[model samples]
Target chain A: MVGYLLRRIGMAVLVMFVALSVNFAIPRLMPGDPVEQQLAAVSAAGGQTGDMAEAAAAMRARLGLDRPLAVQYLAFLANSIRFDLGVSVASYPQPVAEIVLAGLPWTIGLLGTATLLSFVVGSLLGAMLAWPRAPKLLKFLALPVVVLSAVPYFILGIVLMALLGILWPVLPVAGGYPFGMVPNADFATALGIAKHGVLPGLSIVLASLGTWAVAMRGMVVGVLGEDYIMLAEAKGLSERRIFLAYGVRNALLPQFTQLALKLGLLVSGAILVEVIFAYPGIGYRLYVAIGQKDVFVVQGIVMLLSLSIALAMLLLDLIYPLIDPRVAARSA
Target chain B: MSALAVRGLCVEFASARGIVRAVQNVSFDLAPGERLGLVGESGSGKTTTALSLLSLIRPPGRIASGEILLDGVDIARATPSALRRMRAARIALVPQGAMNALNPVLTCGAQFADLFAAHGAPGGTARIAKLLASVGLGVEVATLYPHQLSGGMKQRVCIALAIALRPAVIVADEPTSALDVIVQKQILKTLLAVQRDIGAAVVLVGHDMGLMAQFAHRIGVMYAGRLVELAFVRDIFATPRHPYTRMLIDSLPGFGARGVFKGIPGLPPSLLTALPGCSFAPRCPRAGPRCTVEMPQTRILEGGGEVRCHDA
Candidate 1:
């Protein structure tokens, strides 16, 4: 078992390296000229083009974009290993790692809570939908969920944003918190941040609920056919006990894997939801970095996203035996 | 009184094609401490008949009319809750394909505890261990998952579970059918041994005539949803009445100076369309005009057997 985990960790490290390498290339390949954009912003603030042009050359040499691609790749690899991604061109002197790290909590919090809530609710609804003696009206719910699931997350986010932000104006539409509020650990500020988060989170939940329910319904209904379920029934287990202990317990196995994969995406945040709500999450920050031609910041965010997913998958593999003992027989 | 008595049990399946009469007027009585073996080909309605005893048949299939009296109480008329209470407490089933009947995630001990707890007789580890021991399995076997055991060993766990609550009637549908010949015999012996120890009336369903002849006290021969012959195993074998029963006996492999066993001539009739007369008449050698025109009712022989044929 130790050897298996060690091998998995080894594979995870290799995956991280490959992903970071691709992340390093993406920012370079993107259309914008980072140095020129930075120079233009600085010159516009206070200086002549001639002096700023010389400063741009000096900045390029300092940032080492003047070197060959292979050499830069090695430097990025080493710097990433040391947790040192270059300074963001969008907000110069601030390390790319720092900006991404600052936004990490918001994205993780919003996406994590939204996805968890939806999966729990959706899976419950799905399992109940497949309930052997489900009420007539409850069975009809499958149609609406099927229709709702087909709507993509971004479109749903935009639609929700328009309804709540523009039409009703019931919830705050933009930013993580009020512009002049002094953010603190106290209850009021936390509440403000949470209130601001409601729309984006709701968008994510609404967008994903249908698919999870549909998937779980299929799995639970399929498990209802297994011989063990028949045996459980013949054992005289109550309808509720049989549904939960035998039905849902076994049906959740496949969905649990899907859950892990989805949760792994929490680090990236929901780009569409974040953009529509103007929530200050990593996804929105990523949008800012791209708009400001901050290549290194984009690279850092992508690297963080890939590394998290790879690590989450590794953890998933290691935890499978603990959740279901049948996997232990084969994996051990 | 018999442990189980069924009168005119008929099961039908409603499909897009039509209403298929899967089981037609099947009736029998199983006395306490007796083992009745049901032998037939696949799709012969043996499993359906067994499942209906507990009212556990799947949808599209319903018991059209029947009286399933367990210890003289009719299950067909019992309320859903009452039926649930009687299921594992009064009657238990050792399902076919023992390998798949257990929750893959659960250990043998968990299955035992689940069954015992659900039936209002919660069992501890010591009790479950003892039950497993009774089936020739070690106490540690309870801690082992079903996949860890061989096919025969899994069936043994199923048998141990079947007798755990000391149910009055145990219906085992082809318990040994999925195992190898050697393992099948071992499972059969263990099953009979356990049933003997508890003295539970057993209804063993299988396709092996020779094996059933040895283990079962009486045997009911079924073909195309109808019981053609019902008799003591000795009487059935010594002087077979129904030609279908005769065909089943003749088809078994002989020991000394063996000759090729002649299998029955034609396939069993479809349950969809209505039959003019006897179902086996189209396949019987002595099938005549009257046999085709009218179905024969079950006739009681002088010695001790029920034969459903015109010229028995």
Candidate 2:
């Protein structure tokens, strides 16, 4: 077990190192220069109009863009290890890490809850649909869920925003919370945030519900045919226990692996949904940074995304043996 | 009283073409601690007959009409809860394909715990160890998963599970067919030993005549979903009545029998269409004029056995 853990952790570290190298190379390879872009934007806005070439050179030196590629890459890796992402070019004087951290909580709260809710409910619905003894009426639910899953989540968000925000005027159409209200730890503020989250979160859950259910239903149907299920039934186990312990327990392995991968992509995957709702989450920040040619902030977001995915997979490997005895036995 | 009495058990499967009578009017009874072997070729309904004993046949196949009387309870007509209560506590099954018979993710000890807990029996480590020991498995075997064990060991674990609650009837459906010849004999011996320990009637289903000869007290020969011949082991081997049974016995490989192995000619008839006459009549060497147009009724012999052939 200890060896398996160490191997998994080592794999995760390797993946993170590759992600870091790629993050360093991608922005440098992009067509436009960050310093030149910022300088041009400032001149166009009529904020400063002096010494264009010299100011650009000074900005390049300050941002470490003037150094050799190898030196810059080594420095980038060292700084990334210390969580010291440099200043955002667009949002001058603000560190990229601080900007990313500010949006991390919102994205985690909204996307994490949405993903988990859809997985649980969809998996249950699918299991029921595949079960021979489950209610007959529940089978009809598959059609609508499948149709909803086919529609893009951002489109669903727009439709929801129109219906609830304008037609019925019940939910907030945009933003993370009410305007002019500082986000704090109080019942009223928390409730307001939740209210604003409903449209975007619901859109996400509704769109993914079908995918999870369909996958789960197929797995449950296959599990129902296994010899152990027949023996479990013949063992005089209660139907509830048989369905849960024997049926769902075995079918859940693949779904758990899929869930870990989905969670890894959670931050970047929420970009469209956050844009539709104008929510101040990491995806939205990444989007804005890319548009402003804020290379440092974009690199930081990509790094966070890659590391999170790697960490999720590592956690999955660690817990796999607990859920499935065969994994540990096979690995050993 | 008999431990199990199956009366006119007919199992059918609904297919695209029509209803297939997998087991037609199959009836038998088992006294406590008796071993009855149902031997037949593949698709001869032996496994179906065994599965029907515990009402384990799934949809597309069902017990069309029958009364499985166990300890005065008619399992065919029992409610869902009553059937559940009677399943592992009154009748258990040691399924075929021992490799997959166990839940792969669960430990052997945990599986035993589930079975005992399901029947409202108190299960502890000591009881699990005892069950394992009875099957000649080490106590530590309980802690291992199914994948960690070999085919023979898995079959032994399955046997241990079958006798865990000391049910009145244990149905073993080709329990050793997936094993090698060596493992087959060992597993069967273990099964017989444990069955004797629990004093439970066993319905051993298989197509191996040699195996039936060695282990069964009585043998019932099935041909195309019907019991063609049933008699004491000595009677079955010495004075077989039905032509199919005689052919089955002749096909068995012997010590000095050095020639081309004899195989029964002609395929068994499809059960999709109802046969007006005997199912094995077309393949019978003694088939006569009346055999094609009329069904033969089961006849009780003077020597205390039964046969479903006109010539008998």
Name the top TM-score candidate.
2
Fnat of model 2, as a fraction = 0.79
DockQ of each: 0.73, 0.79
lDDT string for model 1 (B1-312, tens) is 889999999999999999999899999999999999998998889899989988898788889998999866888778889988988889998989787888888888989998888877969999988888888999998888888998888889888888998999999999988899999888888988888898899999999998998899999999889998999998999999998899889888888556666688778888998788999889999888999889899888886679899989
Clashing pairs in 1: none
Candidate 1: list runs displaced more than 4 Å: A24-61, A65-74, B255-261
In candidate 1, what are the lDDT values of residues A152-198, reduced to their tens digit? 87787778778988899888878888778999999999989988888
Query: Candidate 2 chain B: minimum summed lDDT over ten consecutive residues — where?
Result: B251-260
Q: TM-scores for all candidates?
A: 0.93, 0.95
- Per-residue lDDT tens digits of candidate 2, residues B128-227? 9998898889999989999999999999999888888889899999999999999999999998898888899999999998998899989999989999
Number of the top-ranking candidate, with DockQ as the measure: 2
User: Candidate 1 chain A, which ten residues in sequence have the lowest lDDT sum?
Assistant: A47-56
The recovered share of true contacts, given per candidate in order, is: 0.70, 0.79
The CAPRI classification for model 2 reads as medium
All models: lDDT? 0.87, 0.91
